[model samples]
Target: MSTAVHTMNATALKGRARDLGRRVTVLMLLPSTLWFLLLLVTPLLIILVFSFGERSAVGGYAGGLTLANYLNLGSRAAAFSNTLLLAPMGTLVCLLAAYPLAYFLAVKVQRSRSLLLTLVIVPFWTSFLIRTYAWIFILSGKGLPAMLASLGLENVRLINTPSAVLIGIVYGYLPLMVFPIYVSLEKLDKRLLEASQDLGASAFEGFRRITLPLSAPGVITGVMLVFILLMGEFLIPAILGGGKVFFVGNALVDLFLQSRNWPFGSAVAMALVAIMLVVIGLYLKLVARHGGRPGEGAL
Candidate 1:
């Protein structure tokens, strides 16, 4: 009887505590909940309704529903192709460049890490648009080509080419690429690396086996962040590619702004959202399958 009484009292105490905790949590969450509902949720609901409606001849939404918009999805296949291709390429390039820089920053410049990091972020203080514009002068005929021409090179057009676009993508997204990998490598244990070397492993081998795997979470985050944003990229391609290299963002832009086809625009927007979902799903699957940590999947 005494044991049962104690058990009951313990259970009741836990229940009361949980109730109090719930009240506290609700009080804490109320502001954020209301903010999201007002800003995000409501806007999303409006967009969903707009997607189903027709394009007004003048340029906006009209009250009607039809599958014609979705049927036109195939029209932007080239744009989709460019996005799927360039996004991966851009992300891979960023990763290739960023990993070494991150490794150097994390392992080499211990005393100057904060200063170097500040330098990396200094560019971000300015608008990304302004920075991309700086590249224009650099790649223009009078900047790079001019120097090359003085050295007896033939005609060179770097300002409006695919290579220029790639360079722009690399420059714009570098800081984003740097920070995550830096954080991961900075937090990594140095002793494991020494242990590998002590076990007769080369510096390269130790890094390949240990440093890379340990920083896999950061790698995944940096790649995903770059890739997802790349998929929706417009300004870089437009400014650099000279309208030759179209992307989904360009297609959406043309549909909405130039053609005044809101229905088709909505369909394209929906398709973009769908593609993002698929990419995110595949990314999660890959992370889970590759023995990455739980926190990595969340990233």
Candidate 2:
């Protein structure tokens, strides 16, 4: 009877401890939960509400239920098309450029890996706006164009073009793409490659069969990261495209700040959010179909 009572008491104490732990966890999460609610969820809810409203005569939301704002999305079709086209294109370009660098960092460089990695991210130490502004100068008529002109390529217009925007996107987002793929490749089991080699597979064949499949998660992550940001990209296009190229983000800025079309802006934002969700869902489904996990990379 005494032993049974002791065991019961210990069980009760364990239950109380678990309860206390849960309470502590809840307490610890409370601030972040509140912050998420106040900052993210609240704004999203407000945007959703405002998306259904009307634009006031002067400006801003007029607080009425209407689908006119959504219906008017067709007007910005060009911006949407530009964003859709350039975002993917930029992501692909970044991927093509980043993969070899990532592979080199992960596989080839052994001693100065840290230094090289530092070099890769050194640009990030400066302000992003400043970096982008520098690109404006670099691509200007007096910059790369001038150099190219001196090299016999006369009248080369690099600035204020889609190519300039793409260059900016690749330059700005390359590190983001590289790091994920690098981490994936870095953590990969090298033994698999060696085994494939022993089994008479060529380097390319080994990469195709083993390395590529394993590194797929990182590729997906990098692609998603670059693509999503590119979709909402404004500053690069604004600075480099010189009012020639327009994206959904640029349109949003114009609506909110320039035109003060709050309702329409909200509608556009909501639509962007919906589109992102659909794209992400489709991407995840595609990855899953191909036996790839999107969240497999270390970083």
Candidate 3:
């Protein structure tokens, strides 16, 4: 009787497992399916439709296909130039800044790692807009400049400068930049380091051969994330640059809100999307090229 009961239980478990797996598959897909349809797919279709159309006299998308809107794309060359130049630079700066923090948090300081990580993430608790406002004051003439002047530096113009914009970008995105690298570093096999050192590799050499290679995925992810958002960043340039540094984001804002040229704006928006795609593709290619090791899997 006991043997029969055990066998029946095994059969029941198998049946339940199959049912659970089906339910799990549906559960995993539900959120993403909804997100794609509502957020991504819908907006993309709207942008696509707008890209092929013309603008109305009163300013908005008009129902007619035209190539003129796309032809006028060259007018915003400076915006494109600024975005292309700054986006990568900002991402690089964030990486350089974040890597050290993440490294220290992951490798060096073993105590209170949770506390330290919380510190890194705490800034993200606030809205980015609110944080940018705080930067406004900090970069203002009365903020850092005032402090500097007391120390015999007569004049400093941090506010409304490219440097200010860079600072804002780094500050705002540092948390984003840190977390990925930290996860990669924290998940790294400690035994690999031990093995490298055990085999007579020096500290720096061990890091170079082991730690750096393993963390490439995080590096790639952070770079991709920060670079993409920086491309469409208008608020940073608008506030920190004070209208001097024109980005494609700013152009889009003006074309839509100020100029009321919806079709042309849509074209520019589409062009911006294309540029972002190309940049991201190039970034991924670079990552794939350098990120892969002969024996290791690509993350």
Candidate 4:
């Protein structure tokens, strides 16, 4: 009888300890969970709710649900078109420029890798707005235009153009693209490359068969990061584009700050989020399809 009682007490103590551990785990996660809820989830919910509401006469959100805000997306068609075209193109240009730099740093440079990598990332130390503003002068009539004009080129205009905006996009996002691909390449198994070479594979063939396949994860990550940010880009366009070439980010800024159309801005914000979600979903599906079994192409 005493033994049975002792066993029951021991079991109860163990169960209580398990419950205490579970409580501690929840407590540890509570701060971040609450932070995400308050800052991210709550704002998103508010935006979604506001999207369905109407704009007040005084230029704020008004009560009552309606699809009028979404229905009015056509009003900003040019913004959408500009963003959709340039963001992807910008991302592509960044990728093309970054990949080779990343490869040279990761696979070629041994002694100066750290120095070269630092040089690549040094631009980020400056304020993004400052860097963008600098470009305005660099591309202005007293800058590249002036230099070109001296070479018998008259009336050269680079600032306030789509080309200048592309240059800004490429410069600003190149670091983000380079680091990911560099990390991917750095982690890649050199044994695979050596074996391919041993089997008489040329450098190009080896890269195509091994290097490119293994580096795909980095490429995808860089693309997603750059593309998503570019979708919401305004500063570069504002400075370099001089408000001539507008993007969705510029549109959102004008709607919220200039026009003070809260409901319309919310609707545009929701659409941007939805489009990004759809794109990321499609990307995941494509990754899954070409994932080609475990331990295959993955770095």
- Taking the candidates one at a time, how many backbone clashes does each contain? 0, 0, 0, 0
| TM-score of candidate 2 versus the correct structure, residues matched by position | 0.91
Residue lDDT tens for model 2, 1-299: 99999999999999999999999999999999999999999999999999999888999888999999999999999888888889989999999999999999999999999999999999999998899999988999889999999999998898999999999999999999999999999998888889889889899888887878788878988999999999889999999999999999999999999999999999999999899889889988877886644323212
Top candidate (lDDT): 2
Collision count of model 1: 0
**What does candidate 4's lDDT look like per residue over 1-299, in tens digits?**
99999999999999999999999999999999999999999999999999999878988887788999999999999888888888889999999999999999999889998899999989999999999999988999899999999999999889998899999999999999999899989998889889888889898988877888888888888988998899999999999999899999999999899888999999999998898888779977988797653336422
Which one wins by TM-score: 3 or 4?
Answer: 4
Task: Please provide TM-scores, in order, for all candidate models, with all chains considered together.
Answer: 0.90, 0.91, 0.85, 0.89
Order the candidates by lDDT, highest first: 2, 4, 3, 1
Better of 1 and 3 by TM-score: 1
Residue pairs in clash, model 1: none
By summed lDDT, the worst window of 10 consecutive residues in model 1 runs over 290-299
Task: Give the clashing residue pairs of candidate 4, or none.
Answer: none
- Over 4 Å off, model 4: 1-24, 149-156, 291-299
TM-score of 4: 0.89
lDDT of 1 at 58: 90
lDDT of 4 at 90: 99
Candidate 2 residue pairs that clash: none
- The TM-score ranking, best first, is 2, 1, 4, 3
Model 3 per-residue lDDT tens digits across residues 1-299: 99999999999999999999999999999999998899987987888788788878888888798888899888999888888888888999999999999999988888899899898888888988899989889878889989999999888889888788889889988889998999889888888889888888898887787889888888878888888889899999998889988889999999999998887888888898988888788877876787676226311
